[model samples]
Structure formats: structure tokens, C-alpha cells
Target: MATHGQDPLLHSEVRQASTGGYFAGYAASIVLMLAALLVTQQHVLTYPAFLWVIFSLVVIALVAQAALFFGLGLSPAQAWKSVSLILTLPLFVFTIGLSVWMFHSLAPRVMPDTMPGMDMTQQPTLLE
Candidate 1:
């Protein structure tokens, strides 16, 4: 049982939520979102640079949210959660990559030739 100001949940020495930590995490997310918006709405970057910047922001936001909101870290107590996330991320990326590859491969076989420099006469009419 907790006495005075001690958290009852922390009696077992397990981590307990801190108001300050939650607020800091919330503030960081809000700031990051605002920054990403500024980069997009103001056209701060162009083409590939823009894409990379947005991607980087997204990645940073993901890490920050995970660490702050979920208490995820490489510490022994939290290592499992971090490891699980790392392992799962690659699978998600692979799934998306395979889907894109499948679609790209399928398009050529199923769609009629409409682009320039491609032979269009031999293939049957798309509409008829």
C-alpha cells in the first residue's frame, strides 16, 4: 500500500506514469506536426528533398511517440517492446514493397499500350 505521496502502483518498483512525461510527449508531437505542416504548406523543399524531409519527419515522430507515449526503450525492462517493433517494421515494409511490385508487374500485362514508343497495333483494343 502506498503511503503519503507515493504511487500505489509503484510499490512493486514497476514504472508508473508521470504527468510531466505525458505533457512533454504531447508537446513534442504537436510541435513536430506543426513543423511538418510548415514544411508542406510553405513548400520549403522540392521534389526528392521534400519527400525525404517528410519521410524523416514521419520517422522521427514515430520514434518520439513510441518512446514517450509507450515508454519504449532499449532498457532491459523495455527491450522486448523495442525489439518487437524493429522486427515488425521490416515485415510491414516488405509487404508494401511486394504489393507495389505485384501491381507494377500486373499493369504491363493487363493494361493496353498507351504510352509513347510502345507498339499498340498487335494488342487487342481495350474498349472492344
Candidate 2:
């Protein structure tokens, strides 16, 4: 229950909105973006390790944004929001992955077999 009147329909289970959390989430997002840029600019890790680190940072940032910025939590009232997000996450990733895979498969088939100006035919000389 809130001291000030809050719309029951909107916030049935009320939680105090925190400016600190919002700022923290924003700062964290900025740091993650800078870290990604640094990772791309400086080759500090091998390919596999570099990819894993970037992926880990991305997942952490996603969670931070979901919790702090979006106010998603595991509480009874908010659990459904979290559940829905989790359910949709895989679908979203899968759709993007599938799109890239399709493009990769499509590229080779559509590419020209040879250079634009090169002629493949063998022309017999007049002496022959």
C-alpha cells in the first residue's frame, strides 16, 4: 500500500519508484556500451574468449535494464511480466539467428560466378 493515492488498476502491488535505481541502470548501460567499443577496438582476447566476454556483458546489461529500468521483478504481481519476457527472449533471438542464417545461405547462390568483364570462352587463333 502507498501513502499517496495510486491507481489500483495500474499498480495493484505498489513498489516505490527509485530514481537511484534508474540512474544506476543508465550508468550501467553506458559502461557496457563503452566496454563493447573497447573490446572491438582492442584485441585483448582471442576470438572465442572475446565473443564470450561480449556476450556475457550483453546479457548482464539486459538483466540490469529489465530490472532497474523496467521494474521487472520476481514478486507475485510482477512475476508474469518477467515470465513473459523470458518466454519471448528465446523467440526473439531465434528469429534474428534464423534471419542471419538465411542470408548467409542466400548470398553464395545469388553471387556472380565470375568477374564482370572476363570472358570464359576459348577463341581459336586464325593460324590454327
For this target, which candidate reaches the highest TM-score against the unseen true structure?
1
lDDT of 2 by residue, 1-128 (tens): 43458565455444546889999999999999899889988987899999888998899899999989888988776799999999999999999999998988786545434435434353334596
TM-scores for candidates 1 onward, in order: 0.70, 0.66
The digit string of per-residue lDDT tens for model 1 on 28-94 reads 8888888888999987577889878888888888888887788887777678888999999999999
> Would you list the clashing residue pairs of candidate 1?
none
User: Clash number for model 1?
Assistant: 0
Runs off by more than 4 Å, candidate 2: 1-14, 43-51, 109-128
Clashing pairs in 2: none
Error of 1 at 1 (Å): 14
- What value of lDDT does candidate 1 attain over all alpha carbons? 0.79
lDDT at position 19, candidate 2: 84
lDDT of every model, 2 decimals: 0.79, 0.81
